[model samples]
Target: MKKVVLAYGPRGFGNYTFDTETLEFSGSPDTRSGPLIIPGFIDIHTHGAFGIDFMSATVDEMRDLCCELSKVGYEGFLPTTVTAPVAQVRQALARLPDDPMILGFHLEGPFISPRYPGAQPQGDIVDPPVGVSEWDPILDDSRLKVITLAPERPGGGDLIRRLSNRNVKVSIGHTEATYTQCREAFAMGARHTTHTFNAMRPLHHREPGAVGFALTENDVFTELIYDRHHVAREAAEVLLRCKPESRVLAISDSTMAAGVPSGTHLKMWGLDCHVSEGTVRLADGTLAGSAITLLDAFRNLKEDFGWSTAVNACCINPRIALGLSTTEARTYLELDPDLNIVARYDRKK
Candidate 1:
């Protein structure tokens, strides 16, 4: 059988044959329609899917999340915790199992701006870690990979420097910071932006906020929740136009409400949220997270943008942000003519 592989070279797809019995490539390339093979998706920022919230899920429940995600072609993911007390965050981080599919953990934060808490637990929002207190045990968790905070807040810069020193990605989010402040944070060590253009200040002609910097900067990895509701096509197009393929990280900042039917009300990490037309939001209409998987993101981006846009943003870029081995990146999907995932498997042993 012939297959279209794009991971090797992003310029375009190349046709290759596979022996059905041996499950290995058997023949040279040919120019014809065939199943598409792209790298497996890696979700660096997902709260949960299929009704499980990582903020409170047990190890077994988290495994169940993996099973659900794998069905759609996810090779790896980071379990993200919504804003909560420090002790509570520790409990959430400690329960994760040592599974290959589980990459690390993301803290969406206790260290965020109350002015732009979004759907996070507002009352639990705390100051950025100063690294000199007993209540900061959550920072000691080896599995902690990413932390999102408001750089305009006190100690935010210091926290970014410290986390960066330890190789933990500091993603700027939940802020009302100006472009100058955003630039300062970048210079101080923040390298990622959590779900750009959401839960942060909007751009102005005179003072282009965090969104401006995220769009124009080539070095920062910005996360986009490609679910159309979270970000519009025009805005996403602008982002794509300004940043290179390598710097744009598409994420499924999904929550328990994701994939559930519209109007389904659920408590997400203690906040009442509901789904509506595929967008998850709080009671006051603040977008809680998203109701999309990487598969959904990939399809939307591929349909709206192009194949390479989808492949780089959904599959490869997140891995790059996490410092994972791309050459050995396993997990590939066999797609039919309609772009449906017909088969999924590991690519490299």
Candidate 2:
């Protein structure tokens, strides 16, 4: 098999070679493309896009989402679930066909706090199943990568330990957990934070809740939905400066309402939401989610921070958080000086 070389620079990382057939890295750089090349994006958090919710998607609909995301430079993603009944969540997972683009499921649900529920349905928030074998379906699924929960909830700590012991990554979010609670969860092996600063308790001088714990705890990884609407530029800068760039991950946290017309109305998880001015919002103006693609997030970050920072957050950072190996693919993007996609060479089976 011929190895394809991806040369990207002005920032100078030299070339990266990949075996076209297997999409695995070959190490030595040989030139097949030049100027700018980057790995395909890995989105660890996203509900659905183009009007499909993973929670209710048919097999075809889920596969279609994979195709749509691939066109936008996403090589892998996690189909996130909103707070729902265990049976419903299980049904969605059981029905979802295995697609190459779907790395895993990010269960962002029922095991959360009702106080900081954000866009999640309040009625669905409940204690995690306490019985060790109760969630065997989820615990046994190899594709179950991450689970986000509020540690302050009943049985949250035990569940966290159980999931971590099973090799599932636990993330803390959608909570009103105090600083002490956050620390305890971190100690229990919840190493990631889901959409930091949005649904969690805010940072206060005396309190310093989940957000504070994420920043202070160097071992924890933080996911930021850097779509301007979700996190302001100034605040993003603060996060960037405070946390090691490698420890921070950029996610879309997008809803199915993304990519549709601006005025399109969407009924998400039984709540009425509409896409307006590139943002999805509730009827009362609470921010629903972002319509921004991973590409859009990269472009926005590059314009604001510079190439290295943007690439780190969008590409490198996610890989680190997910413990992904570089040998996964040889796919590369040819980007212009301004970081726009000039062309792309994808490795398709």
- Clashes (N, CA, C under 3 Å) per candidate: 0, 0
- TM-score of each model, paired residue for residue: 0.93, 0.91
* Clashing pairs for predicted structure model 1, backbone only: none
* Model 1 lDDT per residue over 195-277, tens place: 99999888999989999989988999999999999899999999999999899999999888766888899987777888899
Q: Find the candidate with the highest TM-score and give its number.
A: 1
> Among all windows of ten consecutive residues in candidate 2, which has the lowest summed lDDT?
3-12
Residue 341 in model 1: lDDT: 89
Per-residue lDDT for 18 in model 1? 48
lDDT tens digits, residues 56-120, model 2? 99999998998898788887899998888778989999878877788889999888988888899
CA-lDDT, candidates in order = 0.83, 0.82
Which numbered prediction scores highest in lDDT against the true structure? 1
RMSD for each of the candidates: 2.4, 3.2
Backbone clash total, candidate 1: 0
Q: What lDDT would candidate 2 get against the real structure?
A: 0.82
